[model samples]
Target: MFTSTERIKPDAQTIALYLENVLSHKYQIPTFQRDVVWEKENVKKLWDSIYKFYPLGSILVWKTNTKLESHREIGGIKLADNFHSHEYQYILDGQQRTTFLLTSIYGNKIANKKNFNPTLYIDLTIELTNVTDDISYAKRFLFWDEIDDRDGQIQANTGKKKPLQR
Candidate 1:
């Protein structure tokens, strides 16, 4: 059997842009797909791999006319309401990675096991240090509430706090 498939290797920024489009209802996730289930640690590791230019693996989408009830919000971003189309690309895989990317970059909250939504934040301070190799890179992920106090604590412990570059 012969099939036509296209493979694209887009940079992180481009991927982010596409996700923004998804939020806008330009694409849809079929109801059959699982909900976002990546834990906080997993989300952080995904970002770390991307930051290091490590391949996170390819996303699989199916182009079809099938329209199903899709997510109204993903990772706490309120998507446009029930905008349907005759043509849709159903996300068959990479749901977790896509959710993490959307939530982390857009500063959206994710649902925890207790059903509480917590906002995600990347420690800009830690990311900067790692990028410059000024200190041993330790993967750090923080929630919105902990960011302010945690930065100081990290500095005190590591003695490697530097101003974040613009």
Candidate 2:
């Protein structure tokens, strides 16, 4: 007993496409949606999941002809306004995930955080071995600050060569 409007279908989108839409303002967050609140550790975990090819869950979007007030920015990244389109897709959930993806890739200027660099780095030198409960990915995935600290030690040891990739 499903009508056309009631039927739901799943669509797969690449990270590139998602980010493009975010930059273009095709995807919008409703005004009622909560602000970005995820800390650095939380962001690291999310990127870790992606690096392992794990499912990052779905972002629910509601398409409607009715336009509603939406957030123009997330984590200091400004989204363009789409006035030509009569239809809009408002994100009903997945605000945190969306924000993380946007901020990590686009960088952010979070309040009270000085010189926050949301850039994520992965150590290609790290070997992939058999998983154990004691094993951690902390060394493999790092933030800018962590890499900076390690870079200082590495620079002092044998000249300078960054190990992490952007």
Candidate 3:
């Protein structure tokens, strides 16, 4: 008995992971597509939603074998092909998610200067001690955004100092 297509689970990380891949110059988007540009409010809304575990929305992906040309360098890195054409998917309706994921997580400089890296709020951590307020975190995206929880107790804990606990 089919569940009437209601059994499909919503994947919150789908867009995020896709954006990461794209930003890392893994999957290339169509060159004719316009550059991603969203304001800080939209970005904060997304981050807040994500932090609250709210369902952002479903992203449409068109898995295709049709290869497309890549846009210019994203944050100084030229996206190159790393997989077979059959696995490629054209983003049908998730440009916003793509934008967030590329600029923030990947720390990719925007091709459009008007929107700089406004969406990025990442900080880096090094050697489990250094938080990157004075450093960059492009190679260690996972280590970024870490809060020095101080043993899982948030009470009376001043998280501002302590080097942000990288």
Candidate 4:
């Protein structure tokens, strides 16, 4: 039986490293788990939350000696064939978050809508800050392809509108 003492509070970098080097490449995705389907906005928000040091809830993993058929690739990342071992950590929850973190940080591609994979890019132009009296910070999700079009679209959408008079 598993115990709660195995839980760890690893930092984002450590988590990313573990996913990229150990989990994704070495481990297998259980057959019962669903495919990653997190929206781009959700992924962006997750990154923003991480950037602001917000607490992203812990992920639960099960340690088991039993082996099952595993995924060869996750979120478009290729994995090396790893033989089944005596001990393995099977993810019980938070697969989406973990996949997003890996794809966003390590520059892996995620499946897109048009049968193609696209890389997730964080918009660095907007700065994140905690205003002393304000409750919200600026954050935007923009793909590399959309960066050039954002300004044009912004102007087109906001330029024609006039402020209401008092």
Candidate 5:
């Protein structure tokens, strides 16, 4: 039953490159995949892991000649619907991670949430040089709604007023 199977070498790509593929319609989520439903805290934790150089589990993608209906948008980034390619990579797992990463990097509006901006912002004032493994990342990373705008300066949920430096 597995006669036609072939093992493909695992390829590593930078986060930027992977997202670029997603933007260019090279990577897509199958229509059957569940929508992104990660809460704000989960996203912050994911970023924390990245900031600490912790390994994020591999994102599994299935490349095939078959083209199934895919999502036109992921994490507010619109994909090229008219793209024509001989092969396509459908995300088999890590949909939540992909969506949050895309949304955090490219600030955009998330669907089904009116006036809710999912763009993640980092509190530069936080001293990350001495972060312990048990520390919560909530203070380091925040969503738009989690920020308090006062006097044109963005403050984190902690209410500490730190000057935004560039």
Candidate 6:
């Protein structure tokens, strides 16, 4: 009976937070949500694009208090919206981006991939070799570090590969 509120943000670390807070997060993927079937290749592509400074698009999530059906084998975990206050469906228009960030960057246990470890981390160094954001901060994208260089520089062979707005 409540109107759903949607939050928007570019490819972010949001996915990691969502999974980490799974079962107890402020929002939940409805049963009607599609199955998480993205393979490692898809995930790899996403991370690669992101590191390239390309726009992975924004992730859309609905937040409400209404319960809904859940998919089977929901990512190697039980599908029960344990909390009543938070109920919603993850309309994953950007599933590729979400999954990669969560599983590869944050090291979150991705659906069906318990053995995978996050390969990316924030390089907390302002001194850059190829930073183009002009923001002095680098994301240290590990997606293609070998190819793009991960020496604490903001390289866009991964998530933010798209051209800059300016």
Best-matching candidate per TM-score: 5
Per-residue lDDT of 88-115 in model 3, one digit per residue for the tens?
A: 7555566666666556665655666543
Cα misplacement distance, residue 117 of candidate 6 (Å): 6.4
The alpha-carbon deviation from the true structure for residue 35 of candidate 1, after best TM-score superposition, in angstroms, is 2.3
* Model 6 misplaced regions, further than 4 Å: 1-24, 71-80, 86-89, 108-166
lDDT for model 5 = 0.77
Q: Rate the local accuracy (lDDT) of all candidates.
A: 0.61, 0.71, 0.53, 0.59, 0.77, 0.49
- The clash number for model 5 is 0
Residue pairs in collision within model 5: none
Reference-based TM-score of each model: 0.67, 0.77, 0.53, 0.67, 0.80, 0.46
Weakest 10 consecutive residues, lDDT, candidate 5?
156-165
What's the true lDDT of residue 106 in model 4? 61
For candidate 1, what is the TM-score? 0.67
Better of 5 and 6 by lDDT: 5
Expressed as tens digits, the lDDT of each residue in 1-166 for candidate 2 is 8887667878899988987887777877788987667777787778777877889999999888988888777666665565446888888988788877877777776543556676666776665575542234666666766755453341221333343454
Higher-ranked by lDDT: 1 or 2:
2
lDDT of 5 by residue, 1-166 (tens): 3354444557899999998888877787788998777887788999988888999889999988898898877887777787568988889888889888888898777665546567788876766645475464777787755677577565554664443456
Which is superior by lDDT, 2 or 4?
2
Q: State the TM-score for model 3.
A: 0.53
What CA root-mean-square deviation does each model show from the true structure? 6.5, 4.6, 11.0, 8.1, 4.2, 10.4
- Candidate 2 vs. truth: CA RMSD? 4.6
